[model samples]
Target: MLNHYPLWKYIILILVLLLGCLYAIPNLYGEDPAIQVTGTHGRMINEALLIQIKNALTHEAVQSKSIIWQSGEILVRFMNNELQLKAREIIQKVVGQNYIVALNLVPATPHWLSYFAAKPMKLGLDLRGGVHFLIEVDTDLMMDKIQKQNIETLHTYFNKKNMPYVAINTNDQNRIILRFRDESTCKIAYQSLSSYSPDIVIHKNAYNCLTVDISTDKVYKVREDAVKQNIHILRNRVTQLGLADTLVKRQGDNFIIVELPGIQDTARAKEILSATAMLEFRLVHLQSNIYNSIPNDFDIKETPEGQAVILDRKAILTGNHITNSVANMDEYNQPQVNISLDNIGGNIMATFTKSHIGKVIATLLIEYRDSGKKDARGHSLLEKHEEIINIASIQSPFSNSFRVSGINNIKEARQLSLLLRSGALTAPIRITEERIIGPSMAVQNIKKGLDACIWGLVSSIVFMVLRYKIFGLIATCALLANLVLIVSIMSILPGVTLTMPGIAGIVLTLVVAVDANILINERIKEELRNGRFAQQAIYVGYKEAFSSILDANITTLIKVVILYTVGSGSIQGFAITTAIGIATSMFTSMVGTRAMINLIYGRKRIDRLSI
Candidate 1:
């Protein structure tokens, strides 16, 4: 009875190991180098498209493992990475611009195991081929834009206060220059605007002008906000694109690091990540004369056909308030964008449309792009481009839901919908550095890491068996079980990316496991030397060594927690696996070894132990 376990204890142990082995089996099946082809806009993958792809690959003399159409997408698995790359190029040329071809990795898990939701653990960009981008945010331009907005705010404020001014504009030096009618008016306006906020520096200048500039503190705050907001929006876009195991994090004050672990197409990732596009709804000034000067609070926008139209500068709704958007066809089979707004946006639209039911409303697309040229100050120049995407007369008062026509094709509609749904970036971002890891390079990294882990585990097992005899054998079994449990947990958990450093964690965990068993084995030997029988020594060894094991593992877990909280990218990946492995090692070293020891020695009386 000294080392005996209850029936339920054995049953629980057996169940846990069974489940661990069951889930761990998926990793052995490995993955396939595959290409995923999905239709763009409203294009749908059909039987005809599948046949077209098959013929293209055949003509290119590229051998494929299988080409199947599933879930409205075409998946072609190849025997190797070279063939997969070849097929992708051929298929892209065949499908034209209507479809998007992307490189992917699909699990070769059996159907029965997949039904149970078992999957292999995800590999990081180092172990898996993917793309990494170092993006820099244009915080200077963002500050400039903010200053222009402040100019508008000042215009409204002065109009309300009945203050007369010739013009309120931003100078080349990025200072707000407010020109007044006379010297007396300039002095009065400066006195009134200087006390507006502590964040602005307002002073009088020559020629009856007043200059306003943002304080240093305000500039820093705006830059911080711009970086944080861009990170959040980039995450939303990656999610909308349906990428898994991706990382988006801030590197410095104005840099963002994005790692797409399973995406190899840099063009698509860059296009989605760097796009600063938004939609604005403005009323078209149909009564204005094109030859005359533009009205106050109005601007001119050109359509695709080179026709200019006057539009209100003030927007009734922007894409920031859009809750959802979908690309679909109208009753006439024409492509259109269906949009939904939040409660506040819906209320604003309801109020605006009720009073002007017959007025023409225009959907304006505003984009800020890099001009590929820098100013004298070494800041990149940004070009603001506006286009009138849609023009329609409001037939009735509508709230929450509406549709926009005048889209050129389904592709345009889909792109607009994706941008609106994912929200807009607060500032422009440019990819400063880009690196692509091909599948072959990933395979090499995987081989090296796997070799390190395998060698470490084998060395640990051999050392334990040589020193402690049968007790060492029991520890070896527990160590193997610990490995299986670690793999199973990583597979089942979401967002666990295995990197090279993560594999190191696994090797370190095995050493910790061996150390734990050695402690117990030495404790048993000491107990036996103190005139104790085999059963009593075994029982006392486990009971006394538990506190030491728990203490050591607790300290390790504390360090792992700190690493995870403060680290990013590959450091976080390392922390994640180490934490999981530490936990699993504790379980296997204590409970698992004890259970096995009980089965072999707890059945009958023994005078001496195998050790």
Candidate 2:
């Protein structure tokens, strides 16, 4: 009974292996060239849309393997890349600009395996051919925007507190100036504002004004938060495009690196990633006098129909309050936008509409665009544009749900809706650098990596079998199990992308695993040579060799953890795959091999064993 395992242990081991094999089945199905379509606004990917897509494809005589909707996007799988390319152009025209149609490669997983949510390991940007964008956040512009918001907040706070002040404004030097009647009032205002806004530096000037500037620490904090928030928003936007494996992380203090895998449309990715779509609903004011001056609390804008309109500066509702929006047609067959608001936004709209029935309300779309120049400190120059997309009069009061008509066409309506659904960015982002990976290069890299893995595995197997004989064959079996378990774990786990470096890690893992088996085999042979019984040698060899195996694997695991924590993109992928492989090898070498050894040699006592 020296190396014997219980019946339950055998059952558990078998179950684990079976589960791993089951999960690994998806990887065998391969992938198909596909086109993904995502509606910009709130276009639903339901059966009706599927029928329309099918009809359009049939009309164009584009043959496809299957069409399925998943995660708010429609995927049309084709037999070959040629058909995929042809279908993309035809579908884009059929769907119009309201939807984003992009080229992709989707897993052709079987229905039985897919029912368990088993998916193949995602390929990284380098492996799947995608776009890489180095986006720089305009920290200077963020600081300015924060300062202006603070100035406005101060104005509101003073008005509410009945504090006497002549004017509150922001200067070119990023200082908020509060003009007061006298020094006594300025001193009081400084004390109050300083307490209210602790992050800002409040100073009483000689001109009876209080100058407020953000502290250095606060500025740095704001920039850091902006970059982090932009990363989160970019991830959400990318997911909305139906992309699976995307990398969005901070590259430096102000730059982000976005790796979108299997996305061939660089222009579309750039547009979606860099868009800052902010919406506002304001009361419109019509003026007859050409030279009429507008108040400080209002702005002048032009509608899409070439009509000039004046709107309030403060919005009754903004995109932040929008819960949902979709593009559809009105009763007269004209395109319109249907919007759903949150509770607070609903209340505000209801109150406004109740009081201002028959009054025109303007829907303003604010977007930020790069100015094609860098500023003095090497930050990108950005310009903000506010356009009135819709000007409609309220016929009745409503809450939560409402519709805006007068959209020029269905395409525009869809684009507006998509922007609303994607949400707005807190700050502007500009692509400082971009790179496209072609499909041919990706395929070649994958082939080379596969070749390396195959050769490494074969070499390991042949050496083990030739040297250790039967025991070597047992070790090889365990190694194969380790590989299967590693891939299965990665496939089952969400967000694990396999890259070329990751493949290298797998090869390295196989080398380490083989070394472990060799160590154990040599230890057993040494024990047998010392005149020990076969059972005793097997027990002693495994018990003693475990210490060395644990030490080696633990140290390597520590290094892998460091790499994972400090590295980015492909480096992280390598770390992840290596870590998982190390863990699986530990299980297979000690548990898996020991189980097989027990079944083979633990049944009866033996004086001599094959070495």
Candidate 3:
């Protein structure tokens, strides 16, 4: 009666263990070497594309287990690494630049377990072998853009306020210069501008020219904002790639570090991450003197179809105004991109189209690519290219939504839609450093870590069984249950990545679990030696040992929490595994072992017990 548990307690224990077993089944299925094919530049991936990929694989004599289309990507699983490698090369040559072919590992989970959304925990970069890139943000271009915007803003404010100034222009040193008629007007303008723009400093010079300079603090803040914006945009774009366990974070003031676990396509990853797919809508100048020297407020650009066109300097609408975009077919069955704009952009489009019903409007696609040079500061030179992706005459007034036609193919339409959906990069970024972790290294790491865990577990089990006899064996069984519960919990939890440090945490957890069992067994022995009955000793031993075990686990949990709070990457992975282990160990050691002991020894009284 002293150590007996209710029937409901046994039911709950059975349910928990069964659920744990269910979730842990996927981990045993392991992973297969595979290659993923994704559309680039807005190419759509569907079931139809699978045939093409399969054909390419077959042409190269690459044996594949299966080919499946999932989440807008094609996954081709290979029977061996050699076939996977051969298939990658053949597929790249066959598909060309329209599709991005990357090497990856696909889960070989059974259909039954996958139906429940049970997946093996994702491995970290070190364990899974992936690509790591250190990208540098071009702060110079960001500052230049900011300065130009400020100059335009000041000019607009002066015009709206009816200030008396001869000319308003930006100097070579990036200062806004306002040339006034007299010192009185200059002084008044300086005071008004200073009061209005606290982020800048205004000074009047000898020639009555007022100079507005951005404050040092404001400049630093602009740089920081630019870096933060780039990081956010990069993350959004990378998410479109459907990568799991990917990490994108700031490494320093102007550098971002991206880790793509299980990603092997360094070239494609670099291209996607560095692409600045900014869009601009401009009106084509139809004046008769178009061949003459262009006005200062206009630019000359080439259309995608190879025709040169003159466009207004100011864009009527930009990528920032785009709210939604999708790839679709026009009435003629030609591929096109349908775009929806925000309210302000909608109003602007409606007004412009209403005034110039027959004028041609151009959608400019601006991209930045590495220029293969480095300045004095060691930053890569980036060149900007602007081309008109679409040019169409306005037949009627419309707002909010419009379609861009004349796309060469469906792949181009898909690429445009993806770029519009992902939004534009705030600034150009270049990869300064890139490192690829091969699959062989990852396999070696996995083998070594698993071996270490197996040995640690075996040693813990042997010690537990040798020390306390039957009770020790019961503890060992509970320890095994703890491991199952930990793995199950990790498998079910979203975004949890397992790493080498996580393996160490699991090994450490086994030691702590065995220690807890030892404490309870020792307490039971003490109670038995003091002449207590077997059932009473079991109850008393558990009751006294609970406090010591709780206190110890809580202390370690506090440390793990701190570690998780301050750490990043693999350190956090370690903390997560340890924290989960501590929790599951407490449940199994206290409740699991107690339940087993109650069923075996609680119902009967004995003067002598094995301890």
* TM-score quality measure for candidate 2: 0.77
Backbone-clash count (model 2): 3
For model 2, name the residue pairs that clash.
40-418, 41-417, 41-418
Local distance difference test, per candidate? 0.85, 0.84, 0.84
Tens digit per residue, CA lDDT, model 3, 160-222 = 998878987777777878899998988889788878866888887889998888889998897
Q: Supply candidate 2's per-residue lDDT for 295.
A: 79
The better-scoring model by lDDT among 1 and 2 is 1
- Stretch of 10 with least lDDT, candidate 2: 39-48
The sequence of per-residue lDDT tens digits that candidate 2 reaches over residues 1-611 is 79899999999999999999988888877788888887653344556777788888899899999998876678899998889998998888778776778887778898888678888888888888889989988777778888888877887899898999999887879788889998888888887877786688888788998889898899889888888877877887777655678888888799999988887778667666755566788998766663277779888898654678888888888887878889899999988888898999899888888998878888888877778888887766778777786777787897899888767667667767766766666677778888998677888998999899889889988988888888898999999999899889999888899999999999989888988898899999999999999999999999999999999999999999999999878899999999999999999999999999999999797887666
TM-score (all chains, Cα) for each model: 0.87, 0.77, 0.86
Regions of candidate 1 where Cα sits further than 4 Å from its true position: 40-43, 156-164, 197-199, 282-315, 323-344, 355-395, 400-418
Task: Check candidate 3 and list the clashing pairs.
Answer: 41-415, 42-414, 42-415
Ranking by lDDT: 1, 3, 2
C-alpha lDDT of residue 249 in model 2: 85
Counted clashes in each candidate structure:
0, 3, 3
